[model samples]
Target: MALDDIRARIRAAEAAAGRPPGSVTLIAVSKLQPADRVEAALDQGQRVFGENYVQEAQRKWPAWRARWPEVALHMIGPLQSNKARAAVELFDAIHGVDRASLARRLARVAQETGLAPQVFVQVNTGAEPQKAGVLPAEADALIQECRQLGLNLAGCMCIPPDDADPRPHFQLLRETATRNGLSGLSMGMSADFETAIAEGATHVRVGSAIFGARPTERPG
Candidate 1:
């Protein structure tokens, strides 16, 4: 039921955006999900998945790769500078690059690894104090700095405040990308992906809609 709903939403969003459904990449966020669930989704034709923690991703990705070599993994969490090497080594894309220093580190790691994983700048559109992203106003400068460091800036990403309408945030991100001459906007999620699509999001990270409710975290 959830998977069907997700497919329906994707279809509707693409139609509303006047884009071919294939143009928007649906990244199934499988941060807390186990490999079996990921394999099931793979069987259902989901080729892209996102993980949050580097350690968790490092543990889960290899098994998934062993079973399905074509699966693409994206890192969609706050990446620490110390974790840059492992992140560059493991994931196919990094979506939480918010600072120039981190971008430089990632670029260096990518260069050393000889694998240029796609990179996205995460912007704190809502300016939440606890979030891990650059303030929206600083995004352009960060992008330029990243380009100077040889990081392939594919697009921008944002997570709007939970209660606010996400359309404005999505619109802002789209405008930011356009102003900077970038093409990708990796905004939106299960709740607000339609708004993101309408506002020109090229990628949407969906979790519960595709993977069911996330499993409860065990006490650390």
Candidate 2:
């Protein structure tokens, strides 16, 4: 019922944003949620998913996909260069590529494994000192660098400052993607996804709003 309700909300957001009927990808963030809930979503036809940790995803999704092979898993959290190979192996998309070094690592691993995942370069639109993204100004260069490394550049992703009005940040990410000839903009979360859709977000990562709060910050 919650999944259906969320989908309805997303469709309404799409309509309100003047986007096409299926312009947005609704990635149910399953991190910190249990595997049973994930299966529930899968039964509800939610194939695209987002997870924060490689090990936690590794622990849960493989067996599920064996049964439901069409699932598309996305890595939507901070990525370590050391985990590039695993990310490439497991994720269908990586939405947290924030630096050139990590890009290079992923490129090399993908070339070696021949399993390159779709990549989204994260931009710190608000220039927040504590966030894990390339500054907005540096996004162009990093995107170009990612292209140079031969990554499958799907588009740009950003996490706007939670306390600020996220619409401007979403617009900036959309413009950055367009200027760079990219088609995807992965912005927004549970709170402002409707506004993000209005500003042209192609992907929205929603976790707690759908699955409810996690008992712990990290997966057990």
Identify the leading candidate in terms of TM-score: 2
Residue 64 lDDT (model 2): 93
Residue 181 shift from truth in candidate 1, angstroms: 0.7
For lDDT, the strongest prediction is 2
Q: Which ten residues in a row are the worst by lDDT in model 1? A: 211-220
TM-scores of all models?
Answer: 0.95, 0.97
| Counted clashes in each candidate structure | 0, 0
Give a tens-digit lDDT track for model 1, residues 1-220: 2666787888898998798877788899988886678778888888888988899888777876887889989999999999999998888899999998899899888888898889999999999999989998899999999889888789999999999999889988988889999999999999888888888888999998777887889312
The true-structure Cα RMSD of candidate 2 reads 1.1
lDDT of 2 at 183: 96
Show pairs that collide, candidate 1: none
